[model samples]
Target: MFAVSGGGRGDGSWPGARWREAIALTLETSTIDNTDNLEPTPEPLHAGAPVRPDSPTFAELGVHPDIVRALNEVGIERTFAIQELTLPLALAGEDVIGQARTGTGKTLGFGVPLLQRLRPASADAENASRDVPQALVVVPTRELCVQVTRDLADAGRHLGARVTAIYGGRPYEPQVASLQRGVDIVVGTPGRLLDLAEQRHLVLGRINALVLDEADEMLDLGFLPDVERILRMLPEQRQTMLFSATMPGPIITLSRTFLTQPTHIRAEESDASAIHERTRQFVYRAHALDKVELLAKTLQADQRGLTMIFTRTKRTAQRVADDLADRGFAVGAVHGDLGQGAREQALRAFRSGKVDVLVATDVAARGIDVIDVTHVVNYQCPEDAKTYIHRIGRTGRAGKEGVAVTLVDWDDVPRWKLISDELDLGVDNPVETYSTSEHLFADLGIPAHANGTLPKAARTRVGLDAEHLEDDGRSGRDRRGAPSGRRERSGSSRSGSGRSGSVRSGSGGSSGRGEDSRGGPDVADPATDIAAPRANRPPRQRRRRRAGALVGEPATDERIGSAEAHQSPVPELAGQGETTRRPRRRRRNGGASASSQANQTVDTQDAAAS
Candidate 1:
């Protein structure tokens, strides 16, 4: 993975063009667009009267007037639903468990409270020169850490709160230096958090407010033990806020183990609300290789200004974006290999519409809130329901109708079915399709057979034909078409031959035939049976009868010799109509073994003919 900057290579050529094309083709072909005449918007649905704070202002949410002024300066006049629900409780120093989806103003839900809780360095001279962070917000991946830290800094700018992010896959010295410089809040992933803790470079003992953003994801990554250890190191009286979209058993277990009887604020997402009301849910079954194609087509449809694509892997994220860019779609990728600066640059381009698509892995794209993301394509169906929700949640933000297209591989049928059932999203049986499926064009609102024949610039943004894929020889798999839409194996890597567990059924040799033959019993020969026809049987009769002619009785064995004259091996005289070939009789030998062998040979041929 080459380091990319400014959305292009140093030479000014778009480095992601190949990837853009690949992604476009995968998504466009794989997605099955909805034809259900359901309009995009529905009615408003909220649990209670919109929570009305005593003072309907930021200052009433325990935010210092100076902080409120700072927030107001940034155009944040009123608190969002999440901020209103979580701020009052957080300001009161109570542990909180806030359940909300992405793009729901969750950053400020915890950020503002944490910033408000900050206290100037203690008067102790011994600690005045030393720098130890008082807060830690642990996220799942590096990209989210950077995104979260930036938001926290922006919200806390006037308060002069120093926020720092430390995540893995980059230089450690800078993080250590940042720690030395005394950051007020440290946001990072589990591995780096543990590393820094063990190195004694960052201390959490004095942490007053510990926020576990996207807590379910941290739990999913097997970081619960680390999270527990980190929690143990913090002050016993510290406030712990666990936030996630969907709560699972493991997360609940963690909350029970660590968080005090927290305020259980459940902000349910309603299909009738503006956010959920306008979100369009489309489900389709398609070949795995064709996902990028399907997405390409969807992105090009309706001129939806910006889109974010979610894939299950970093490699897939890169490939999806690269495929789209190659097709001339202004696209960029955000994942682990990129630097914070590089990731930010790509995101800026996407937000500004300079780049229409941002392909990202689930972990990398978390906490990234880009408004009016017209479409969010799950290039690959997520591993489970929670992930599926998060991937699509990127779109449908800020009360705008957004489209989410999920491309399901055939193998993912079971997994996606479970998600569909759980979410009540009536789309469980995805249509089996490939890149060439006519339905794909209809779904994208593109004319069938329009591929490649369109103007180059228009085609670049979407609909790549099979002729453009790079050759990396592997096996008999078709490169020009979409993947077979088979489920990807859990640990099976995608090789040049493509992912495994493919079903092949047609005319072919059987592997078990040889084994069966080796163990089977042999059959008996009947060539020399005394009761058999003498050397020959009459040619298979094709009898024709006169209109009034009578048929004769069949010949008996006793008269076989007389009738045998007509059953000659050679053709009968020209005047004769038909003849039967006589089975060659073996000359009898005095030796039983020789005679038996000859009879066996004759019987084998007779059996074959029969």
Candidate 2:
């Protein structure tokens, strides 16, 4: 027989019944908030209290003393505040959500604990090269992946805990081969991590602990979905630690969903005091093209040890790099288009001081953990408030104050205004100026003429004279009638033809030859006049008119005679025969004017009678 109730008195008041009821209530709350039932609240931050180490001896933390000696050999004396707080919780197998900025030494904070729980990876397991990784650390950028992987490998050198990093923009075959052998710990960006997982080259089922470094930046890059999917693929019993600069709502929600009773650790507010107080902030409004000039001047003025110039696009980053290179500066550009090998080369060059300046896009800027960057210049305004903060956060790290200069274009005023408002920077209307303005020199703390220092002899002290440049770029009179410094003449006299014809400088008859019958040189034939006027009237009406008309002669039949006949004579030729022709008297028909209509009718009647 089935018995559902635990009460002997047929009522639900028995202790056993109460126990059942309590279990049900706990399950209900667990559904609402998993943290409520699984873990205890985290410890609060103490300003002056000295934090204890996770263990008294290396053996106690499950690491050999030789490994501890290796750490000491590298000049690591004491643990950072985040390491102190997170190590104990992470080692105990409890989930942890840590809030801390970059350069706080959080890598070892989560890394050391993950290494403590790892079993000697199998020799034949996929990706298990003699000392390859079993632990996986997902970072936001390829740079961070390489950095964190290197740090972890150094920390595990004595333990022979092999580490490898997998990321995009590189060949996948090598990564696949590495996985085929085996790795003790794997650090990579979310995209490559998922790709390896999906390809069956890497497996998360055996990963005992998973660390998501720079969780905020991962979210910013729209990597949360990939992070969530990766979490689902891991064993439910695995340890999860999330580290980020800030604890926003999404971080909290993530903690609730993936982490099982995570211990929240945040450094004392004073921890951030050194960074905030030391860094100097400046904002200015200028044209987009002027940013290059301003950046040049600022770089010359500051002479900082290392500088990182951040831009919004890869094209701009390349352009800034090219401009600086042309000006004889040692510069490099990092963007998505470069192969992984090329990108690493540039980063290495910049880090080793072979390159003085690094121009990079947002993807390259975020997650960059360079230690000595003294200045960060936003060559172009960022997209949003978060990006603005992240861009400047690159410098002013590791407890040293740094300088941040932002160049805001006119079109980006509204976006910059929002970011400035949020940060309380009071730069709503940043100094409206230009690159060549005197204020630019003063603001950048440079001489007014930073253009170039030319020697006296090279200055070419000359004055302008009344010399005109001709069409051939010579300075003399243009008597050949070609285009000169004056505005090129338009609307040629040669109609419907190229400008190869000459102008009529003098008056003449048909061929500029005199004619006996028509009086002066024969009027230029209407069809033969090359420079004939282009008026709308018929050509016949435009022919030159005679000085005197024969009485009663129709004007159309007589035609117009040359006006220059009496004024000039054709030059005589020695061998030419001159023909003397008699002038013919013309029989003329007259046309009456409109005012003489009645007289015209009488004349016509008389003619008819005759």
Top-TM-score candidate index: 1
The clash count for each model shown is 42, 17
In candidate 1, what residue range of length 10 has the lowest lDDT sum? 22-31
Expressed as tens digits, the lDDT of each residue in 278-376 for candidate 2 is 567778888876777777777765446678899888667766776665454556667754334334545655655556578889886666666567888
Off by over 4 Å in 1: 1-55, 122-127, 271-276, 287-294, 335-345, 432-439, 447-455, 458-610
> Model 1, 89-163: lDDT tens per residue?
888888878777655566777888888888777754444567578788998766567667766776677778888
The global C-alpha lDDT for each of the candidates, from Candidate 1 onward, is 0.60, 0.59
Question: lDDT score of model 2?
Answer: 0.59
The TM-score of predicted model 1 comes to 0.62
TM-score on alpha carbons, each prediction: 0.62, 0.61
Q: Where does candidate 2 have its weakest 10-residue lDDT segment?
A: 23-32
